[model samples]
Target: MIRMMTAAALAATFPLAAAAQVAPTATVAEGTLLDVVAEGRVNRVPDIAVIRAGVVSQGATAAEALSANARQMASVLTALKGAGIADRDIQTATISLSPQYRYAENQPPVITGYQASNSVSVKFRDIARSGTILDTLVKQGANQIDGPSLTIDAVDSAMDEARVDAVKRARERAALYARALGMRVDRILMVSEGSDGGAPGPVPQMMVRAEAKDSTQIAPGEQQVSANVRVRFLLK
Candidate 1:
């Protein structure tokens, strides 16, 4: 569902300084000014899912840990490719080799083992197949996984819709104010965009197990795309 809200204030005079700050091209006309702030929102189901998948390996030496991690990560990448993920959708996110330490009562910390990790960010255009592919990645040696951030792949259309709604709301609000003040709206002096963005719904991180019998399920509920606009109307 789409929602719209508007707040308006009537002013006898508009300061030229404030008008210049808000919109450089705005020209202050000779009339009572009505400023309206309107917000429009559209709710939509997410079409894309982004997840981070990786492998972690530990060994006595850094070389051994890195080698093991590399081999495991290779399998994970192969699994993703086999699942119809394009190379452009997969990006290497992190890679590191760190020393694991062991502390004693009165001695300096000693190096116990080395841990190596490699992770990649994967964008799944098909939301329905993401859960199953995640399960397959885990079975193919991915031990570390994060996210599944649901988002709208194509947001331009939604944003344009919201913008139109905001403008319409602003015009109605200005008309209402003009009527109440025993005046008529002559013309719109200026319009400027305020805070505008899409808010994605929160999704919990999945705790996947290789031995689990149940299949992983991903649910992308709904996200809201919003647009805010400030409009100035001349009342005569």
Candidate 2:
């Protein structure tokens, strides 16, 4: 019985001794490794614009609603072509026909009418006239206007700017860390990139009623395009 008790005590103390032996190695490995992060941001002016414009018509029948919507949208397309929008720049985005419902206190929901809507995506090369174009569209018959989401069509330049900024930031960090630890930075052990996720500028909304004879007011304020990047550097 005494021998068995001694064996049990030895078994319990073995793990404690092993844990004490392994603790120092883990601490040393963690101390020698360092992780660094650097961020870069750049702002540029937007050069391209995208607009979503469409027509909405409602009538007693689905065919009538769809016909009315088609007629008005055709006129809108003609006006856009006259203003220099290329064929490739215009695309039909949506066409939806839904029944209009009316409810009464004592009766089941009745189909009162039907509505048809069609939307188009328009890209503008000349941003100066974007507002004027909106005004023209409303004057013609466009009832639904969604956006003028601004963008920088050529993103390569913006990406280049971000890359340069990232390099500068990484170098600045490496110098700071080297100074602090009294060690010199040798070379970049690894370089990995994090995308900025295609930065979009801004989208402003403009509203116009069909009853208005003249074009709606347009205001295209300055839009800011931005880019971001993260870089990691190693030290010796």
The best candidate in terms of TM-score: 1
Candidate 1 lDDT by residue in tens digits, 1-236:
12112213333343323312243255445567667889988889999999999999999999999999999999999999999999999999999999999999999999999999999999999999998999999999999989988999879899988888988998888888888879898877667777689998988578899787788989889999998877776777
lDDT of 2: 0.65
TM-score of each: 0.86, 0.75
TM-score of 2: 0.75
RMSD of candidate 2 to true structure, Å: 12.2
Q: In order, what lDDT does every prediction score? A: 0.84, 0.65
**Candidate 1, after superposition: displacement of residue 234 in Å?**
1.7
lDDT of 2 by residue, 182-219 (tens): 86655443344544535554456666666766655444
User: Which whole-number lDDT from 0 to 100 does residue 213 have in model 1?
Assistant: 75
